[model samples]
Target: MFTFPILAVHKVIARGEADAAANGGFRNPWYGTRPRQGEKPGLWLVGDEGIYIISNGELAGGQKPLVFYSDECHPKGDTDWWDYKHRHFGGDDGIEFIDADLLVPSFDRNFGITHPGIRLTENDISFSLITR
Candidate 1:
């Protein structure tokens, strides 16, 4: 399986009432505790091809996120990219947060210009594709 790193750019807040319906109100499991302010959470993307970041107008609303393959910047070396994997993800593969909007960047594009959205519920976060 091919593995890629997924980073959540933004802070996660509590969705208050919607906590129970989300992904079991689970916080990011990668860190022992919640990340400090301005800290971006990350996960590993493991699949045959790759993953896609989608979004609607709102945060974490609209459609569920989807994964697909692309001929983009797929870094698979033991450099800073690999170091990031080891540092944030313990060198393993996985996925997290709530209430807050998640800025997920496309594997091929620059995050500043284009990023998908994910809404954080108390329990879970869902992905939506953003159209330019």
Candidate 2:
């Protein structure tokens, strides 16, 4: 499941663009453009069903990350994971490359982003259970 996260109220040592170098056009699915570096989470799950942003501590604390369903959960053409400043839509609206069905709710909510349909993958998702 994917999610469009806003800046949470917390203090963290964030790095540059979630990536050290903007060298290649591609980006890591887990880290994205500005992934949390160095600090290892208690658990992490990354897959084609998008990244599930949750946490062990938050789960224990009775909190859960917002899970947005998506088509291509895996990173494509350089997805940025650390871009919390703006909303992150699952797919692009113009073409028929990536998908956006289950992501409709989030699209309607964030900037009227146009989403078409949802995607189903056979693999189980791995992710962090984050706090809302």
Candidate 3:
């Protein structure tokens, strides 16, 4: 499995975008295509905690995306996971691509507690971790 320092998460996003741009524009790997017309933006959690924010599609394996209070710890219960998923993703399990635009607020509200380096903006998000 691929493991990245939490701070390096933004590189993952940049690399994904670079790959898509080089290929022929933006195609979400998870969906294998650009989002369908009218699809709302979504976000996905990277690093050790793999969560997602999907704007459209069907959920498989009961895997709902979530924005957590901290990535330092995993979700303690199903309620925390599902609640975030439902609130942000409208309970849609069918999301393919996590929207780039939504990364900042989502990370700040969820994972920022532990990873203060999680910074977001309209253009990009930056992340870093403090090693204890």
Candidate 4:
């Protein structure tokens, strides 16, 4: 399991271009991207859709990373992770970024189960992926 930094978390109102107008003309980062396959490998942790490891070459066709999410969750929008920064991280305006990684134990995409060990505290968030 290789660890990658969680660049940003976008508040996904909806997927694809269907909700563009409501989302400021921006489609969810993973809108036109497909899951990682063959020699292509990219991964994203979606709040509503679990993890999506995209194909390597898919981004060249025009697709954004899944790091940008809706700005409605945290009080400061996309500037922070929930209220962790203000509530527990010393009450400063400092933003504490985290890292995310994807592990593909199997190539099966049929499992729709949500990871149950996702832990969110004032200072950290963690997740584990186990595809069946």
lDDT of 4: 0.31
Give the higher-lDDT candidate: 2 or 3.
3
Please estimate how well model 3 matches the true structure, expressed as its whole-model Cα lDDT.
0.40
Cα lDDT tens digits, model 3, 11-96, are: 44554444444444433435544564423333354322223322232333563422333342234543455554444333444323
Error of 1 at 131 (Å): 23
Q: What TM-score, to 2 decimals, does candidate 1 have?
A: 0.23
Instruction: Give the range where candidate 4 is weakest over 10 consecutive residues by summed lDDT.
Output: 1-10
- RMSD for each of the candidates: 12.4, 15.8, 10.5, 12.0
lDDT, residue 124, model 3: 52
Give the clashing residue pairs of candidate 3, or none. Answer: 7-128, 42-99, 56-94, 57-94, 58-93, 58-94, 59-93
Tens digit per residue, CA lDDT, model 4, 24-58: 34322334453321222323333332222221222
Where in model 2 is the C-alpha error above 4 Å?
A: 1-45, 48-60, 72-113, 116-132
TM-score of every candidate relative to the true structure = 0.23, 0.19, 0.32, 0.24
Write the number of the candidate with greater TM-score, choosing between 3 and 4.
Answer: 3
- Winning model by lDDT: 3
* Local distance difference test scores for all models: 0.32, 0.28, 0.40, 0.31
Indicate the worst ten consecutive residues by lDDT in candidate 2: 8-17
